[model samples]
Target: MAITSANQLELLQTAEAVAREKMIEPELVIEAMEDSLARAAKSRYGAEMDIRVAIDRKNGNATFTRVRTVVDEELLENYQAEFTADQAKPYFEPQKNAQNIWLRDGAPVEDFAAGPQIGDVFQEQVPPVELGRIAAQSAKQVILQRVREAERDRQYEEFKDRAGSIINGIVKREEYGNIIVDIGRGEAILRRNEKIGRESYRPNDRIRAYVKDVRRETRGPQIFLSRTDPQFMAELFKMEVPEIYDGVIEIKAVARDPGSRAKIGVISYDNSIDPVGACVGMRGSRVQAVVGELQGEKIDIIPWSEDQATFLVNALQPAEVSKVVVDEDAPRIEVVVPEEQLSLAIGRRGQNVRLASQLTGLDIDILTEEEESRRRQAEFNARTQLFMDSLDLDEFFAQLLVAEGFTNLEEVAYIEQDELLSIDGVDEATAEELQARARDVIEAANREALENARGLGAEDSLIEFEGLTPQMVEALAKDGVKTLEDFATCADWELAGGWTTVDGQRVKDEGLLEPHGISLEEAQDMVMTARVMLGWVDPDELAAAAAADAAEDGDAAADAAPAEDGARTEEAGA
Candidate 1:
């Protein structure tokens, strides 16, 4: 192919066709063509020379030019493309003469005295090259590669924002147990594990999936689709429920067992909406639509509550809860249900409680009412035994102390004397004697723990950290954290215990001080305090940072107040 005037328009027409087919901008295609033409020109001319091509957007006329840059004498390396400032005088002489001519003719003359300095560029028009077979083949490859890259870019930009949305696609093929779906303008992959159980598809079968993710890879944009995602069901409900679509009702949380049962917590902003009923729809139409799409997966649509206990109770629906005990520090809940409802509350193989745990973001232990009563009785007996042994009290006196909520010697030793006196048949003298005995037991236990910690190489720095108790120090020493520095280096989660995700399941990480009832926040404060005491962190700097954070929070709250007030005013007007 030759670069001739007759075929210049053909170049633009070909570029437009390729761009339309690739779904990319025509200008990008033209830029690619210009690059390919420049490469061909470089081959025809000297490869060391800087050759560039520009196609006029209006007429598609190709212009080839050789570019040389003026550089410092020491920096000039490429002879054909770069020249020292001293060697550029010849190129600037003509421009200087042109300026004089303009000045003599009373025409405006811009300054040209400091002409052709370093870093200045010079361009000269060059004859167009005739493309030989080899050069033409190379140019074709360049254009194709560039077009493919632009197509990939277009696909990535199109789908990146569509993540977390539902998309409809036709099944294209199956590769290694992964379903390839033809989402218009691109392809997406639905992994085998992301599909609902036993959901098989043949080529050309239409499928709806959640756009779980869009990642840019070397080959192309990877769009990950999922049918078993919890969000998929929530999205289906949003599609079928007008109230959810309109924001009058919101799906707060969703937990799915894929092909089995699922639970979704919903809340209504409008008092009259009844989010659960709205999602269920008339005659179960709305929920049935979702269930059918999920392959007959039963869904429990429960009302969302700010109180986690209430929400958990609702999440374990069709199973009556007798009582709820929440352990906030551990973030676990114990739900007591009647003996008959125990099986239903736990579901088949604990599925109900598992879904409730996921929905409420807490670990749930479901026990029958009888089991709960026994556990409480055991705890009461244990406390009574401790009081009897530590305070030297009789069985009735120990039972009285346990019933009054004195669980340990520490509480009895530190509590107000009036509290013990308030117990039935307890006088001031009896209370005093009980407190004295309780203090002696607690002190003796502390001394014993300190002795053991010291035996285990516990240092005075750790023992005197103030926030940590003697037992906590002993535990730390047993765990090899025998110094204040070691304690400071420990993470808050390591000090208070936390759950970690392992193999898609949460596993408990036991903490050294967890048995001592140290909360995560308290552990953090103690660690930071230790760091400050050891001079690892400056307390003044910490104070300044905290003040700055408080100021930013105050500013943000102040900024939000006006917007909230305006919204309220608008609502009142409405």
Candidate 2:
């Protein structure tokens, strides 16, 4: 009996010790203690009995009890859980009544209700005894399981919001090329692919990595970390450089080649503060610290400019840039470097140019000064010859047109007469003649294209549709979309995307429409117009159907305009 009482006290003391070890609240541990004890009691008692255990939080005192509830003999439906056959046996005879607690005359018996009132809880103290070995093991298992669950929940809550921040941990071990770090409260995994290629770590070595994700799994919360991520290097700079931390200098963008090289584009908000000098610190002390942490990765700090061309030149550092021709529409840049600097601009294996593209967010094509000059000459000759052939102009007149930025017949035909006449070597008579010839050639070309497309079995409805270019109609015919009905039945993706498959399976039919350089909404509008022309749907009906579909798909905001021209064209996302 003394041993049994000592075991009861040990239960509460064990819970407190486990709670402190697991860094959980003592209250949670006590709850575990009660649950484990109750499980052991249930094993000793019958499975159907109401057995419960409660541990006092203030002391180690425990209460073991068998719980029952009071019930009204007159009301059987509400007292099902608490009512038992033995309690009602007193009222039942050899043949039980409809209400088991009622007398044979169908009247309720009042004898059983005086002891315990209806809807009252009744608990009976249980005697102390030695729990069987199996039941004791069962209690320990329950306590461990509950404690583990609570610990997992706490760890998840602790690291959920720490993603994207830099974290420090000690390298505990490595398995299958992945490093496992022992963070203060939990473990983090840095996969082999996330580590810098030129670096290595030994056991107990401290390291810093970016927290990429914290995912809850069946076993526990997995903290995925990365060291080669561009954001990781950027965060390191944010820590080493005070200007960036205080928001005086903004790190516009970062591109890294892991331990080999990296580039950072920075911009200053204040006119007096120089972003590069501040990041470099006094005598390059700040940047050196960052570089040392990165395993001697070369760092290039470039000043960011709103003018993308200027920024690109700055990003391609250690290489001189002579000229930059920007195509804003294509979002590409043609950079011309001196012959002596071509190899430097391109770098060894194109690393320099690659990083420049990432930093500026533009496609860069590097060209030598000589190659650029030759390309410019070729463009000039091509434009000059085009004008001479289309308008029957002499080389002198074509040269003037090309120099004035008139590259096409449409420009020459639609340009204001005054603007054309104001050109250096052009007079009003010459401009009028150029405009007449341009208009005549354009009309002739349109007639020929329509005739060609019609002969290819294109419907007059499609030929007359102004939205599609002549080439578009020709391409449609080759794809078996000649008639208006064929055009109306085409799906939006067939005309917009060339291919998008699912799980290595083709989602689109073979030989279907391919991308014609338009968005899906544009393709949809084309189909709608064909339907309206074929008399399959009235314009207003087509508009209503499109709006209804858009609203149903939760895309009404993109097509909010009334679908007067068939359905309103859906714009590409910003």
Candidate 1, run of 10 with poorest lDDT = 564-573
Each prediction's TM-score versus the true structure: 0.90, 0.71
- Which one is best on lDDT? 1
What is the number of backbone collisions in each predicted candidate, taken in the order shown? 0, 0
Which residue runs does candidate 1 get wrong by more than 4 Å?
95-110, 532-574
lDDT of 2: 0.76
Looking at model 1, residue 96 earns an lDDT score of 36
Worst 10 residues of 2 by lDDT: 565-574
Which residue pairs clash in candidate 2?
none
lDDT of model 2 at position 535: 83
